[model samples]
Target: MLLCFVDESDQGDFHGFAGLMADEHATKAITDSLNRTMRQVAVDWGIPATTELHGHPIFHNKEDWKHVPTRVRVGVFHKVFEAIVAEDVVILLRWVHVTRLAERQARNFYPVNFPPEQVCFQHILQRAQQVSATRDTYTLIIADDRHDRDRHRERFATYQTEGTPGVYMQTNLDRLLDTVHFAPSHMSRMLQAADMLAFIYRRVHTVTESDPRASREMAKLWNTLVDSGRVHNEGNWP
Candidate 1:
C-alpha cells in the first residue's frame, strides 16, 4: 500500500497541497531518519528535540526557531530535505490560483466559500490513485488536522462513486482507501515534512520576496525537490 501524507499551504495568490507518498514498509525508515535529522538540529541549535518543525516558524524564525540565526534555520530545512531525499519518497502537489477560483465562483461554478484546500486535495488524491494503480497497490491519505478536514473526508466519500467535481475527467478514486484520515502534525514527522514542503512550494510560486536572495534560496529548495526525480506529478489548475 502507499501511505500518503499530505498538508496544505496558502500564499498571496495561491493555495495548494503537498504530499509525500512511500510504500507502507518504507514510511518507518523515512520517519526514523527525519526524527534523527530533527534531533541533530536540536542538539546543534539548543532546542528541544520534540519541537515541531514547520515552514513558517523555521523560515520566519518564530518560536523555538527565533533564537536561531536565519542561515542556521535554513540549514535545518536542508538537513530535513536531505533525509527525505534519502528515503526515495515520491512527492505530489496541486496548486490553485486565487483569480481562477474567484472567476469560477463568479460564474457560480463553485460556492463563494468552496475551499481551494479541497480542490487541491482532490487532485492529489487522484494522483495517488494513479500511482497506486500502476503499482497494483492501495492508498491511504493522512492529512494534517486542519479544522476543515472533515469536509474533505466527507467529500471523498462521494468522489469514490460520483467522481471528483469540476474536473474534465471522472476519477472514481477507488484505489484509495474508503476514508481520509486526519492527524495532528505535531505528532507526525512525515506530516511536518509535508507541511514544510507545501509552504515552500506555495511561497516560491506565489510570493515575490522583497529580497532577491530570499526568493533565490526558496526557489533553490524547490528546484532541488524537482531535480531529485521524485516529484511524480505537479499540477497547477483552475
Candidate 2:
C-alpha cells in the first residue's frame, strides 16, 4: 500500500523564540502551489470541480473544512488524498509546531502547551511509535527542508546524543518506510505547494509585524485551532 503523508510546520508563526510572526507571502505562494497540485489530482480522479476547488488556504482548521476530518483538512493535498485513501494508501497529516523554551527538557512534554516547539516534535515521535506498534506498514516522510535542513540535522543529532527519539530516529519505521526528499523548487508538485504555503505566511508577517492588533488576532486564531489541540486528531487502531 502507498501512503501519501503530509505535514505542516510553524503555521502559527512561532519559530525558535520567535513570536507569532507569520510569513503571509510564503504561505500564500505555497497555498497556491498546493491548490494547483490538488486541482490536477482532482481532475485526474474525475472529481467534479466546485467553486471551492482548491479554495482553502494551506493553513486551515475545522472552521475552514467541512467534508474532511480535523487532521486532514481540505487544502493542497485534498484531491489526491481523497482518491488514494479509499484504496491503497492512508494519508497522515502531521502538523509540527515551533516555539520558545527555557531549555531542552524532555520530561516537560506530556500535557504540552502552545509556544513550545520541541515538545510538539516529541509528541509526533511518540505518536509514530504508537503507529508502528500496531501497523505492519512503513511510514514515508515528505518534507520541505530547503531552508533549514542542516540546522534540523544538527538538532536531530543533538537529540540522539541526549537519548531522545524523534522522527529521524525511526529505524524501525524506516525498515517499513522510505523517506522521499523533495526540493522546494518549481519543478516538483509537492515542493511547489509547500513553497506556496510558506511564502504566504512569510509575506503576511513581514509587512504586518508592527501592528499588534492584527498580529494578536492571527495569533489567537492559530492558537485556538492548532495549539488548543482542537484540530489535532488521530486514526483508529487496527
The candidate scoring highest on lDDT is 1
**TM-score, every prediction:** 0.92, 0.38
Report the C-alpha lDDT of model 1 over 67-152, residue by residue, as the tens digit: 99888888877877776777758899889887787787888745445667677777898899888887898989998997876777
Residue pairs clashing in model 1 are none
After TM-score superposition, the amount by which residue 166's alpha carbon in candidate 1 deviates from its true location, in angstroms, is 4.1
- Those runs of model 1 whose alpha carbons end farther than 4 Å from true positions after fitting are 108-114
lDDT of 2 by residue, 1-238 (tens): 2222222334453321111111234334434544565565456544333213221343343222344443333333333222222232222223332322423233466343333444443344334434444455443334444564565455445443454554343333331233334343434443333333333333344346466754564454333324333222332111
**CA lDDT, candidate 2, residue 13:** 35
Residue 42 alpha-carbon offset, candidate 2, angstroms: 12
Q: Supply every candidate's count of residue pairs whose N, Cα or C atoms clash at under 3 angstroms.
A: 0, 29
Per the 3 Å backbone cut-off, how many clashing residue pairs does candidate 2 have? 29
